[model samples]
Target chain A: MRRSRKKQVIPGFGISMGVTLTLLSLIVLIPMASLVINASSMGFSTFWETVTDKRVLAGYYVSLLCALTAAVVNAVFGVILAWVLVRYDFPFKRFLDGLIELPFALPTAVAGIALTNLYSDKGMLGHFLGQLGIKVAYTRIGIIIAMVFIGIPFVVRTIQPVLEDMDSQYEEAADVLGAGRARIFFRIIFPEIRPALLTGFGLALARALGEYGSVVFIAGNMPFKTEIAPLLIMGKLEQFDYHGANAIALVMLAFAFLILFAINSLQIYYNKFTKQ
Target chain B: MKRKNLITLGIVTTLLAGLLTGCAGKAAEDADGKAAKAIEITNVSYDPTRELYEAYNVEFAKYWKEKTDQEVTVTQSHGGSGKQARSVIEGNEADVVTLALGYDITAIEEAGLIEAGWQSEFGNNSAPYTSTIVFLVRKGNPKQLTDWDDLVAGGVGIITPNPKTSGGARWNYLAAWAYADKAFGHDQDQILEFMKKLYQNVLVLDSGARGATTTFVENGQGDVLLAWENEAYLSMKEYPGEYEIVTPGISILAEPPVAIVDSVVDDRGTREVATAYLEYLYSDVGQRIAGENYYRPSNKTIAEEFKDVFNLELELATIDDELFGGWDKAQAAHFDDGGTFDRIYDGETQE
Candidate 1:
């Protein structure tokens, strides 16, 4: 195996690795390191105080709860959308596939303003909902709606390729074994797409956690209610409270890192178990 | 193969270096050409001043040309006042800053960009024009929100921006505070209660003044909007009879100040032009343009001329009054983290 790797097509492994590490450090690691350094420069007590302040804690709660809800929603719908696009031959399939990526292409602010306009109390759909005594905008529901809008593309794009690459032989064999439709999907197809779904779910979760633009517009930003962590950081910055902002941001960074790390470990463990 | 790779790397580096130098050379040439024919200055301002400055910039350029025999071009950058100040501090190369409040410019000054006593540099605390807070209600005064006390009355939904993020919203908060101070007879506890009730009625606390306007006027969510007098007028102009501006019995005198960023002007060799640009805002034409844009002119004569246009009868509170002290004290006491505003929401949420 070692000899085969050495004789592979791409040469200059050392040079390529050096370039990759340099670019990664320059583009990603350096800025993140500065954030950590800035946060740490404030004493631990101050950091703790800033992060644990009731308003900031409320912001974190709002952000985490809304992001989790949005990610879960995207996960369920995204899988179905990806499966349909990959498995079926339908009219406007290509157009629908393109449409799924609109959230990714449109500026988040534009998406936010457009969503706010459509969901405000006086808006087209909102008027009916208002008459029904349901308030969507300026509430937690609005925040989740904005997050889901920005997150759907992540889940769908991640799952679509895996679905397309999935082989049909497993399902056909399961069918030949007299398995029911639901059983075939649950036992054969689901297991194959589980890793992709998890990856998509993690990506969407991270994206929604940091979402600011669209969510802020629809959030109404009521403290202890609709204020998200990013807005808290912004509010701190607006007051020229740099140390406080960095502290809150550091806590959020740690949270996002832990979530992604746990998801990746779960995928690895699942992959190992399945292979065994 | 190694030799070929090295050759490719050498070519790429050479191209990148050549491209960078080529761009730098072009920029230098362009600067020299512009220096010979015209002087350019960038005026960094806050959001609501976009239209005001757009008109004023053209007027200033013409004035500069007539007086100095040199063509001048003015560039404008606008955003949330604090964000714009941070941009300048982070080296945005602003020659002049006409921000929404003195505190924002003070933030820039503390960053060592502008000289101290910048407020005293121009007339009226360096504020070319002034505006006050008022209510923008739906047509026919549906809620009849005539005063600040009525805002806290039952069934009246209010829309205002968060003071922490918006310079204009700080004025709005202070204006309400002033009203409460008078209404509650200088009793701190009663004023706090009044403020809490007023905020409780706020359906949407947007991040900026314009956003509050959108929440009130466009979204149709709130019964009344606490907005700048100029902003209220601009909304009426845009919507045409769909909204009405009600001058509250008492409000804050919102003085959006301007100043030349000393370090930047000295560095860029634009002190003279920048100073002239700001000073020109005090000129007669400048005052008229400000009044026409719905901002109450700081020039007493011009303000008198526009008396019919603006409600000059109401009592206006100044930030330097005994109640608030100054911007620094006001900010620390009311809008800072864990301050009165946050405490109000904190207590409400706990209940």
Candidate 2:
């Protein structure tokens, strides 16, 4: 008998791969390469001067701090939100689920203005906060809040499906074995969901890194204080310093890539650890 | 099932093709040809000129039609002056740029979009109208704000855009500097200290003039808003009794300049019409419109006609005076990177 051929369930990997490669190159690789090339065209000294300037450095610090803080906050709260939606049923359960995606759907500028209004000294929320002597709008806290608003969906959406698909049998077994709630969560559920949490955190962090419109309104944009990296890049461009803008943008892109790489490695390590 | 999937795929592909071609055609029509029945020119301007330009576009279109009998359309794009200048430098096709400050137009000239010495091409150094920085306080003049001093006084919040980004804010910054410089008899250290205090009291720094206004009026974020004179007037007009325009004893003469983008108009064969459109800004009708809109008209007669509206008698400092020198020197000493602004904010004196 002739050698039997095994038919594939999925069709045309070659065509699909070609399409994926073309789209990625067109959308991502080309633009990133152009940015790097443009940044490098400015001599090394100029690039150094642009990125290492104190104001630019401060901007980078603010952006990284707020993004990371917001991402971590999202990771914790997002998991709780996902868990609640997945484990509980309530009136407007579907509505709350739908509302979780509002940030993704809303224009960032509108969200920013709305948030600024809500947290301003005279705003409904801000009025009570003012009585406590804590200023939220126009401070670093405001930047983090805005980032959180923009980034919440990234974490929730990332981990929601994982939580839903997870079987409750492991938790049941743990409980039957006289395991405490904390031990059950940490020993069983935590290991399984850690990879998804890391992915969500990374996504939220990345989204916050490039955020602009909302932050500007609430940032108060004090140079070397509340200004973020993207605003600095925009400031350079506004001053007609294209090379300088590119230099700063290239630095941000590099830093973000490095961060995302580390997060992915952590995710892979956890995934492997859980598999065994 | 196979036939249904094929039909669905066919319809989707056709829709995508149709959408793509439609966009391509729409873009092509923008710069398709020169003098194709109707000519369109883009005026990239700074914030606060929106209403002025909207009125001017209608007037200019009428004049262009009455003179050349060719249908003409005027489109406007407005933002922070420096930002608008950057867009033009990045190859935005603005036939004319009417910005809040001349330095922005100078930047475009430096980029070689317009010929050198564009200031001499039109009257008043190519500035058709002038404005000043004034205080827009909530009704009853809360914080007892009178001049630049009160802005920096204890427990008062001032709302002004960041000078690094806003042209109007630069005017606002310099006006404060001029006030303190004069008060202290040009003591640089004292002036720097005063600026630091003033900025410390700035509750929020918006990126543009309009954004600053919104922060003050809508968000209720500041006590006194350092604003363009026209903006202050417009706010009082829009919300009667909610705000008051307080003219300071001395204010800087903010000459918002207008210029033709020579390269753009030349390439589009619109040089003649574009030039006329900007020159129309200095005409009697244009001057009257400018005057009525709270801008100090270049024409003395027209400006006097609207004296009740503009409060034109306020002593105003010109940039050409010995104090600020000019835009070039001022831009370097103050607004440039690592300049006075950065030093003041960094709490470092430039020794």
Candidate 3:
């Protein structure tokens, strides 16, 4: 036993490794494995047919389009919000910082309801927009709004710490070299935070893609129009077509993974380009 | 150091108390010969039955205690009817499922959770009370949404849940189908055309009946809401002048069914109590409670007393009747994937 034992810097390594693997397998891997097993049980042809159905295709389209739009919106506003919080000292600075995480804590159902109530035709903002014939609730715009609500915190939380840790010495050096505000931001500040921004955008996109509760309440759930992928999965589950539900969910997972992978690759390329 | 000692002392005392309670509970469960045995049953139901079952559970517990002298505990889980049924099929351990439609209970049967012919197991086809579909419009009948025709008329924003996910929306769809079939001399194409128009006018299709009501009432999203008679009545009662129920000239009689999950009851050894609990729904007290909740009770005497609340003399079709056939056929032809609903909305090539 002494001859076979390998020397390690940390003791209890075997036990710790065993515990981590067991916990992960039980909590995450096993459930995901079941989803794969269920989807495979439907057979490849059946899976292809179910995922390629017109309604499922519509769900995928609507979910991707809305999530993309919402993520873009969140990225723009999240950067601004973090910049202000880090660089400026307003009266309600601390309160505003705390408020950024409200969406994370408030139940998505309540957010959906409150958002619907605010943007409906009879609501204060909606009533004014109705005069201009611009309907928001029960439309794709409403779905995007709900998604933006749920996704804002992801972007903000991911970028805020990086922004807070950003060195001010570089900006002072650029200023000494007589670089303008716009030039310094583009050549110096932006390159430093590019990786964090990409990570934030990826997280916000993933969150919006899987968002169900808030989107469902405001999506209007019109089958070829405003329906989302998760709602289609729910509809299938309700119909007792477990195989079909699993097939669609697997497709969604694949799509989300592809997008996240693409974002990660882009982030790597960004880092490579900036370093050179 | 003193504060640290106090914290340790408090934790020890709490742990000891928890241990004592656990032992006491185990002893109570094991002490079955002399003392009243405590039993718990879980009743999984649909969204709108929250109020109905809360009142019924209390009454049933009291009745069970008086009858068997054993303490009875009843717990309820409520959500969308189809979702609730899906949970039971996924092993929710529901001793009884009081869903919004017989179709949902049949789903449980299909899952082998309950036996076949569960409808015949209890009185009145296992539906203690029945309700019909109706239109709930803004107060003063704005837009003059009186009957089915008005729902499909141009510029009308109708509010109803998706039939694919909601039992109430199935009733609303069938009610519309029945009206169109009768009005157009039973022409199938005309009925489809009419239904297409009606759905085209649907401003928002919620996932569940209660959600549709909230969208229509609270969010003010639509002009008229197609809803269950009981839900419409409850809305009228709650928001007195904000909305009013419009009993259409034709509608579908909705039978929301209940059944004991045979497998679950057998596993829990609560079959006797579960059976008796459901049978109690057909009893006199249960009928009174059902009527009080705005449901059209199956008890003839009690139903007659609630005529003023449910007074309607319109033609009503049913899901099990000739037009729609039965739940299985209806589920296949209409709400199933690539069925009529998908054809109309998503333009699926029907299989």
Candidate 4:
């Protein structure tokens, strides 16, 4: 494998690899390693008890369920929004496109506050929704809304470039071959963008899973209900239970890693199947 | 290629050396300044005391200057009480801490940053000012929520922070528990049931006192807010005719203590200033600032001066009393993981 390597256009591969490794180690790996080290110092039984506590488990359930729902929602609407932005031109197109990135730019806490205000029973939209007997803020629904607001940018940004880069000839050829619009999209267009969509889905899911600041405001933070895992960690830290907090965090990190791994493998399998 | 790598390595080493020397030079300058007529100390405090300290710091600085002829700069860091204490334990360089609860200071004491008996370092258990848990209801009190029993009555929406994360909320919980203890005549089962109902009425358990106030005042979700006395007064002052402070007949005396972080002050050689800074909190101007900021002054005379401003009629339960024993015992029995608070929700979830 080493001998089969081809030369790259970009030189100084060694330097670039060194820089990347150094930055990654400094920024990510070291802190994560410390978390692992701290969690491991707590005996396995205590760590198990901390993570498997009823309230902790409930927090994990709420966080994972809300994040998954939010990711699915983002995947669907993010695609539609990205499709509209990339395929069509309209008034304020640039403005609308710029707005997609607003969630990414705005602090998550600000988004949480703004979304809470917009969805609380007395809020502008919330009042109308209240008339319809729909409640958003301070519930699981509020958590999902905050997650979707923050995760939408990840999905839209990821899929937009993929959609832009795809050639129109494939669609044209499929259309000419007597395929309907739906068939062309599902059979031809979708296969090409599935990898990007999965990536976006993974990113959004991962982001939402760890989101704390935004969701806490809207979560109402009731145990066995709206309490999220990150808030549980915060609670543990406040109690000076660093070991318990690290244990919970370690479990969350492990779950997030597993989900990312599963998505990555699925993407690889899809890429291979499409190539064949 | 080897020569180029060598050149790059040499340049990097030179830059690193230059950066290290720059930092060393700054350290030297700081060391020199430590002997000069200027000093700085950091006061790490809890959330609601932001205004209290903002007013107190300026007065303390003037007093310090007048006394010692030295210009003192006091940096303030505010956040959740326990979080602030944890930061101090993890080395945030806080010369002194004025947090929301005694347990937070106890945690720091356990961490060996402050002395074991730091509570008695100054007057009033090192708590120059005190507050209590009170109810902040809407202007007209439409719920007719007069006391603790009204909270547990059906259909009354309540808002308070999570006790596990908020020191003030712990006091709120203890206050409610104290009321239950008295009302139920110390019947454990009845008290637990009463506490359960009170928690069940809570619509939003925000992570901090300020957030709970926001949930009550800004979001307009809950019918009443379990708030710090100072916080309730501040909200009333901020939005007149929109909210009213309802001092419950029974509440917990929330004595937020202050202590010099021995390790940090000793290391930074600011022990004198840090000690004086906290000491000044009991002074006349300091007491006045505390009163103006709605915190009950620890000084009897100062407290008397603000008797009209504060509610002195309510019976305030002390954490150090037999009810809860102390902050440490109260924390372990009530707010700790799988303690009463957790069990309350656990029972609810099971049902």
Clashing pairs in 4: none
Docking class for candidate 2? acceptable
Summarize candidate 4's per-residue lDDT along B90-141 as a digit string, tens digits.
Answer: 8899999999998999999998889888988899888999999889999899
Give the per-residue lDDT digits (tens) of candidate 1, residues B9-102. Answer: 5565566679889999999899988898889999999988989999998998888999999999999998999999999999999999999988
RMSD of 2: 4.8
> How many Å off is the CA of B347 in candidate 4?
4.6
Model 3 bad stretches (over 4 Å):
A1-12, B1-36, B347-351
lDDT, candidate 2, B131-227, per-residue tens: 9999999899867888787777789989999887788999999998889888899999999999998888888889888989989998988789999
Candidate 3, residues B293-331, lDDT tens digits: the string is: 988898888898888888656678988888899888998
Question: Could you give candidate 2's per-residue lDDT for residues A1-276 as a string of tens digits?
Answer: 011113335655434455555557668999999998898788999789889987888899999999999999999999999989999999999999999999999999899899999998889998899999988888899999999999999888888889899999989998999999999988888777888889899989999999999999988887767899999887776666789889999999998899999999998887787679
TM-score for candidate 2, please give it. 0.91
Please report the TM-score between candidate 4 and the true structure.
0.95
lDDT of 3 at A30: 91
> C-alpha displacement of B94 in model 4, angstroms?
1.0
What part of the reference interface contacts, as a 0 to 1 fraction, does candidate 3 reproduce?
Answer: 0.55
Using DockQ as the measure, which candidate wins?
4
Error of 1 at A123 (Å): 1.2
Docking model 3 quality class:
acceptable
